[model samples]
Target: MKSWLWLLVGLWPAFASGNDEAAELLKRVRAQHSADVVVSRYEIEIVRTEWQRTVIMAVTEDQRGGRYQGMVIAPRRLADTLYLKRDGRLWMVIPRLRRKVGISPAMLSEPWMGSDLSNQDILQGDAVIDDYQHRVIARDGDLVTIESTPLPGRPALWRRLRQQVRRDAVPVRVDYFDQDDVLQRRIEFSEVGEVGERRLPMVWRIVPMPEKGEYTLLKVSGVEFDPTLPDDAFNALEQATAGTATSP
Candidate 1:
């Protein structure tokens, strides 16, 4: 009863192997997902060149492998963010001046607000089995277009990622390619179901090279998973009370 594989953290991870219907759609997304994830409050809206000029609001709480607290409201600098994950280490907290930033791995590729939210695309399912390597290449109706790449000296940033998963446990749609493969980015998944037990991805539209005007639209309006978040709200005095909370 315990078997949940597949784990690729975005952009590039040119994995192989196809046929067998991508191994039964990676065994139904590793038996309905579970790599740890917890969210109590959720609200993300970031649109840079699709409608609203610049609007970034985020209120999050995560506790999977441990820690991830956010507070980012933009209009002119307002960030009270903190992302922790003890033992394995990964910390970041910035309240204007209050510090605690140390998230390496080459910063995942940097660019969260300038778009394409990296940091391994918000820590994609945590334990990424050696960064990526999956197969399956086609299927339409219920999607399932996997393809990752990167494993030998990984310093990836789109070398392959044509994922469009959803074999019942939805929440996916990816397409980012570089290293001569072109296709910059196009990850669109709007309002997918289930949040409590998993099956995430409420909404995310990041089209950076599609029409060429630079794009970044993320929407996750309301999602509750693992509720009851209080552990000092995430220490550091809630990152200093998240710099005086704001944005509904």
Candidate 2:
């Protein structure tokens, strides 16, 4: 009977406790918004040279979930570009070719748009569980800091990630570290509000790594969640007809 009592006592904390509480909350947040996602249309302007060009992008991001796709359109250019995440596979599509090219794991380290940001950087936000071991560090003004230690099994070279949660327990800031345990990137979230009752980050700034001057800023303006975006909008023929792409 004493052994039975001990087993029950141990199980109680698993269903209710301190470390378990934060874990449960994270699980709940991830589960609650699994079906609901946020989508937006963005106008991207990257000014790296004297000739500034504009691009239109359609994006979709899930909260605490996997999957993010961006369709980049170059005005009066060769072809519209498509970046897709299907079943954990990342592919790039060119309208002219009508073929999807697989993005290799090696390209992740390459700079994106000649900026400090990389393709891997954008994809890193997904699979937080696979990257960091979480611990509730502290609470300050309705905000909580959760220090995350990078797991040994992570394929990428990241040292640590510290995420800041709002008073209501939503992730706001995510900071990244290098393999040498040096701060590499800081992602700042602003204009946070509700997207169909789920709090989300609207604007993001990717800060520069030490010794790496300049940074990348991704602003999500005119955000609308759960829209009537049709699968046909992603069709390659449409891009060709629109004169946005050439023949592959």
Candidate 3:
């Protein structure tokens, strides 16, 4: 019995080592999506059982300061609407009302313009890397599945998240769960293609909870990485006052 106990103790280090390797692998997968600066044109479609609506927007991200900004350019009526995030602050600007409103922390979970995506989803980029504790839960062929739990005191909407990533560092799918361990949504990534120096999914399909017939599709129409984005590109007031439409 003592011999068996010693053997188990000796194997414990190997288990700890495996956990460390999985954490590092997860980081590499996240790094693939990171960029110094990124500018892209996106087409968002909100599909319902009886109707659908489409919106086109130009989005820019400055990874250094964790800033993101988007401006609506299409559908005429919704034109010039802007969403901005800088250093953890979020704001919305409406051109017609000439109003710039600050987004409260509680509103982060609300859907963006009736789409399946939440405001937090757009503003919080790569947050899983730092805000959650990750571990490898399973592996199949070239794909690795990881489960993430929010670290202590971290402010996250989902109680847990599961992600599947390929060996080539591409994120294939992600599942979000609530505090009761109920699955809330699933996001699938596809259309792998070259975007600047890296290959990324150009299409994202988001399906909300309860298997509803509604879903949201986001497609990247154009993208440029590490471009010389203007210093005030993420300033909500500057963008609203300019009243200039951006095209891909």
Each model's lDDT: 0.53, 0.53, 0.68
Instruction: Write the residue-wise lDDT of candidate 2 on 1-248 in tens digits.
Output: 10111111111111222365555545544432344445666554444434544556766644324445666755756335776654454566766667666667777777755555665545443533444456678878877776656556656456666667675645567677877878887766677667667665555555665634355555555566555556764444333233432212
> Worst lDDT window (10 residues) for model 3?
1-10
Q: Which residues of candidate 2, in runs, are more than 4 Å off?
A: 1-18, 24-38, 44-55, 60-68, 74-79, 97-99, 122-124, 152-156, 211-213, 228-248
lDDT of 1 by residue, 34-130 (tens): 3344343333444555454454454443435345555555555654455444434445566675666666667656765455566555555344434
Off by over 4 Å in 3: 1-18, 126-128, 230-248
Score residue 21 of candidate 3 by CA lDDT.
54
Q: How accurate locally is residue 91 in candidate 2, as Cα lDDT from 0 to 100?
A: 62
Mind sharing the TM-score for model 1?
A: 0.29
Task: Name the better of 1 and 3 by lDDT.
Answer: 3
Q: What is the lDDT of candidate 3?
A: 0.68
Top of the candidates by TM-score: 3
Q: Using Cα atoms with residue i matched to residue i, what is each candidate's TM-score against the true structure?
A: 0.29, 0.70, 0.83
Candidate 3 structure quality by residue, lDDT tens digits, 39-149? 878888999888899999887776676666778988899998988766566678878877777777687788988888776665554443455676789999999887777
